[model samples]
Target: MAVARLGTVVLDCPDPLALAAFYAEIIGGKAEETEEGWVELTGHEGTPLAFQKSPGYVPPRWPAEDGSQQFHLDLTVEDLDAAETRVLALGAKAVDAGDPVRTWRVYTDIAGHPFCLCAC
Candidate 1:
């Protein structure tokens, strides 16, 4: 038997509403600011994603410069080329860090958190 089940993954960001909005845009859901500086996204197919305000939130450096990335989201896309174009329009910045394979690409949200668009 399982002791406990997994819950929503919460991300710390300078602007909870903005970060949550970003994810909601890609994930197809509504981002709700339920409380002061706290936001939650739902109505998607899988686990929920939430955002919490960090007063002194310093965005992570992808190559781990000033601070290392603690975690990242891996999102599957049907068409990498199409998704890339759309995400970029939605304020996602592609990371130039060397990716040997063409199966996936790296990008950062407006808040500078790393995520991947995987074709697998």
Candidate 2:
């Protein structure tokens, strides 16, 4: 038997509710405010994502030494082009990694957390 199972991935941001809502919309879930500065997205078709407020939160500067991204999420999609359009409309900033033919593309969320949309 396994010693443990994955629960939720919590992200620190300036606004918990907003971050929770953003992930909820992308991942198919409902955002619930448990308390001030805390929110949870549950019932997603995938894993649950939670958000916690950090007053001094500094968005990670991807591709840079200072405040570099700690981690990222890779989401598989059937249609990369379509997904990219939608994500961009939802405030995702595409990262110019200069590998157009790759199976995955990187983007940063509103709070500057790096994530990827993968075709594989």
Candidate 3:
């Protein structure tokens, strides 16, 4: 039997409350408490962001020799420049780019997760 198909993407964060606010701003919405320090953002409806609390959670030092991350997130936007601006405004730090800042640009979230902003 096929299990019920439900839910979308959910990001893991050490601080749900803080991460919730961060994503809420970038995703353009508010985050609701799902369980104590754990916050959920279903404001996007189809897409749900689940935050798990880990008191000792330490953000990875991405693009550095500190820690190695197993994965990352990528978002597509109509305009790369505009999207970069928006994400930066939401507290995303620009990681690095090749020569030109076109096509795609990598950025690290408040939690130090590397994500890409690509032109669609």
Q: Which has the greatest TM-score? A: 1
Worst 10 residues of 3 by lDDT: 41-50
lDDT of 3 at 39: 81
User: Which residue pairs clash in candidate 2?
Assistant: none
lDDT of 3 by residue, 25-91 (tens): 7665677886787788766634666777777766656576865666676776787777778889888
Candidate 1 residue runs with Cα over 4 Å from true position: 65-68, 97-101
Model 2 lDDT tens row, 1-120: 999999888899998988887877777788899888889888877777889999999887777776557798988888888888888988999985347677888899999998999996
- The per-model lDDT (C-alpha) reads 0.86, 0.85, 0.74
RMSD, one per candidate, in order: 2.0, 1.8, 2.8
Number of the predicted model whose lDDT against the real structure is largest: 1
Please say which candidate is ahead in TM-score: 2 or 3: 2
For candidate 1, what is the TM-score?
0.89
Return the TM-score for each candidate structure: 0.89, 0.89, 0.77
**lDDT value for candidate 2?**
0.85
lDDT of 3: 0.74
User: In candidate 3, which residue ranges exceed 4 Å CA deviation?
Assistant: 1-8, 64-68
Residue pairs clashing, model 3: none
Give the per-residue lDDT digits (tens) of candidate 1, residues 1-120: 999999989889899988887888887899898999889997887888999999998878886876667899999988888888888999999995245557888899999899999886
